[model samples]
Target: MSEQNVIASLLDDLTQMQSLKTALCIGQDIAQYDLNKKIQWQYFNASDILNLPFTQRYDLGFVVFNDDLNRRSQLERGQIIVKLRDLWAKHVVVIAPQGDDAFMRSLGLTRIVDDALQDSQQTLWQFNILSYKNTPDWLNSKFWANPENWNKFRW
Candidate 1:
């Protein structure tokens, strides 16, 4: 599915959730959408993900990994996902290109759907962070194995 369609579908699903009141979209600028008016929306980049303030938790978070050239290292990207999960009160939705499933899964994201075809021969993987606390111990070990991950979260 196209990025627009995926986003629309996600927004639609989120809107149906009575508990979802605020959402943050990271790594992608989707300010043009009308949905922004319906929900409290905030935008951020990968560089700012780590510094994001936790004063106000969001009901949902989205990270769009569309630009391959501007991507961060595998470990760094995984860190971003972890941080996003921490900021979200309920769930985090990630839109990533194909072949990154293993990396995302290692970071504790669950694949919500099979690969969907997109333009430019790209396939999109829709992964969700439902509950960080419920993640498998093995996956959590892989995520926390890097000291950098722990250092980043240290207050």
Candidate 2:
């Protein structure tokens, strides 16, 4: 790509990163205020800084998929969003990795960042903002909820 195209792509990617942060924030709030009644939290960090605990958590991470999960076709967009919101509302930290434009294109979304300039192979680009949700007491009441008794619908 020409230098101009590359620069433009990077800027576009940066913008997408901002959008992702906004989505996450909205997702987080929906979980706390709209969906899960028991959870509570506040926005604690910006997406760009990795020095803080927000950068430390590994259990939660997001990757923009190709939307090839045909098995998940029955699920509604609101359902997926609700699930994500619940997780964030529960204080689970997630990072939405920037994906390739081609991948994004396949999903009917455009790619923003270019990997060559950034010297990184991963598609996750941009530093947006980070939000937090309080952990629920029911889960912590046990090391792990027994699968036998757990309801698959809620889990």
Candidate 2 on 1-155: residue-level lDDT in tens? 34334433443443444322232332223332212122222332222212233322222222222232222332332233234433332222221233333433332322334445444233432222242224678767455756766775464
Q: For model 1, state the Cα shift of residue 33 in Å.
A: 3.8
Quote the lDDT for 147 in model 1. 70
Ten-residue stretch with the least lDDT total in model 1: 120-129
lDDT of 1 by residue, 27-93 (tens): 7766445264677788888877677666777777777775642367887888777777755545777
Candidate 2 Cα errors over 4 Å, as ranges: 1-22, 25-102, 115-117, 124-155
Candidate with maximal lDDT: 1
